[model samples]
Target: MMLFCDISLAARIERAETRLIADSSDASRARRGDTLGFALPYAGGVASFAEPDSPLNKVAGLGFEGVPSPADVDRVERAYAACGAPIQVELSTLADPAVGDLLTGRGYRLVSFENVLGRTLDGFQGEPPPPGVQVRRSGDEEFGPWVDLVVDAFGHADNQGVPSHEDFPRAVVENAIRDMAATGAWRLLALRDGAFAGGASMRVTDGIAQLTGAATAPEHRRRGVQSALLSARLAAAASAGCDLAVVTTQPGSKSQQNAHRQGFSLLYTRAVLVRTA
Candidate 1:
């Protein structure tokens, strides 16, 4: 029946979402600096903390294998509290609505919604980069430049009167790069005329590759730089034996359009819940 098929599809997506979050948490833990990062596992979920001012300091990997109870939620809250940060959780509307109900009952507020998109790589193909554009794996010398390019491309502004990059220290960025490398993730850079034009990063786990932080310099917009990066990353993921590629973007945004054009389908939407300290 159609209902049965829909339920099966939803179940598959839920499983994928859980794996994505857990792998992402592990990736974050691998990137933790001495005093600025931490990841704790509790029943039915995981809590992660990055730089106090960085956007990545929050909890994910929740309700993938089982629905989280109020007690589980409290455990995660305590874990983050020990790190001196407010509790923030990312939940998929499709995975387990019960988890969202539990958080809402506990006074967490929905903060944002992100569209999770994915594509199968059974017959994957990639377009070549634009003329004079070179896509390559980033090295140690490229880490500083990589951070600069990503910050500019994303238009990340200073927060609480601190410089954007200062709030997100270079050390954290370096650790992330190193962590990705250690876990078989690819750190890619796009160069045009020997100048950095864009950057993208991806990590493959259990046959799925997550493409994240794809950004192109403002001056390089509309030049196919992002398209080139996407193509290259997809090709790389396929080569690594990944059967699926996933990305999350603001609903109906330009990024969503790009993903659609590249054959990715909108899988589901997830909202972030926050509880301020």
Candidate 2:
């Protein structure tokens, strides 16, 4: 019975993921900036290129509803090639099983598997932030610090191995924040003693909200910063009429454990497949 329930929830999560990527792509295209994203007719997925080196450029939402044919694979390659970027696809095991064989036959290699977890928001409750800690929505002027904190927390690195907080261009962060906000997403920042400690973002679609971009300063680890942020986001999502909240994380990682403690359950696992230009 539990297995059956898991399978049913996985299907729901897969549908949610497809919608998530499509909505995100639409938002990116609407911005009409350096980033270019669109729905791929052949692959039944969304393709996006945020930057020549940024990892956000890739294809997703594939194989959720149906399998991609050999011609679909060819079209994907052509689409990315036209943009001069390497081809990458994120596929869920819950998607068409043939998707794996098709991509592998086409020279795509497995990259990583990310676990999708979710929880219902109805009657959800969150604890208040610890004393001396405050959480709030970030403003435009706070983008720099928010980005800095996120980079520091995640240790983000670019293609050339340049550290994000020190070497990444500030304009990129500004544009990303602006694009997120323009796409109906909210960026949250956590502060301790008036100093930036952590940040996260949430986007809602069809009563579902996805929590992403979560990060915390190294010094702030285990200080309840993430818990506070999670609670705040869930409350905000509920207020926005969202009935479900989803997040992705490395399996068995602290993030996953945290989500579980908050009543989230595993939905499905997805692997990223890549083919270099």
Candidate 3:
């Protein structure tokens, strides 16, 4: 009997380890005031802050109006400073290029790129988990683990050079949980053989169900836990009247592997462009 298992699994462990250390380092920096809070409510949408005194403001929405002003920036900064978060900024193709130029002028570094991948839920192939494993809707009791898994899956699983998992603070996690519960924005799918081996969360917005927080435990390699959880979410989404499901995955990661196996395809690749503040 060897002290280890599959080589494929060993590679994953190394990736996860690298991811964890990088994430923690980023989080420490964010906690020390290197990043900014970009989630500020405005008329019809949200404006992102790139820095404490950035000239450019980011306004994004599925569908909304109005742009950020200096006054708006001041308001958002004050709120973020009080909340102990960095100012964050966001921009989309729909957003005016002027905003980007403004941020560029102000020396705000842009980062954290991701692809907004989507596919029709119709004819998505897969079956639910095997017997002995269960998927549960989450509540307060399950929030901690859910958040932790999300942090692990994305914030600490890849070699991606992004911020740390610690950037997700109590307020951020709490708000996410509340939103998931209130709008049915998310469904937490837990796979367990009497206990959790892996899980994933799905969120639906405007007929699009987005997948996040898909993870398998260290002890449960190749046990088909993640696949089952994914299948369950797809079935649930189709039943819930979703027209399509979207997911973002790191290039060549295990989740991407699973996605291809389960019938998801690429939509677009978004690069995270960052400049240190």
Q: Candidate 2, residues 191-239: lDDT per residue as tens digits?
A: 9888898998888877778886688787877788888888899999998
RMSD of each: 5.1, 4.6, 12.0
User: Which candidate wins on lDDT?
Assistant: 2
Clashes of each: 0, 0, 14
In order, candidate lDDTs are 0.69, 0.71, 0.52
Model 3 over residues 4-53: C-alpha lDDT tens digits?
A: 22333222222222232223333433544655344455433454443333
What's the TM-score of every candidate structure? 0.81, 0.82, 0.61
Report the lDDT of model 3 for residue 28: 33
TM-score of 1: 0.81
Candidate 1: stretches off by over 4 Å: 1-37, 156-183
Candidates ranked by TM-score: 2, 1, 3
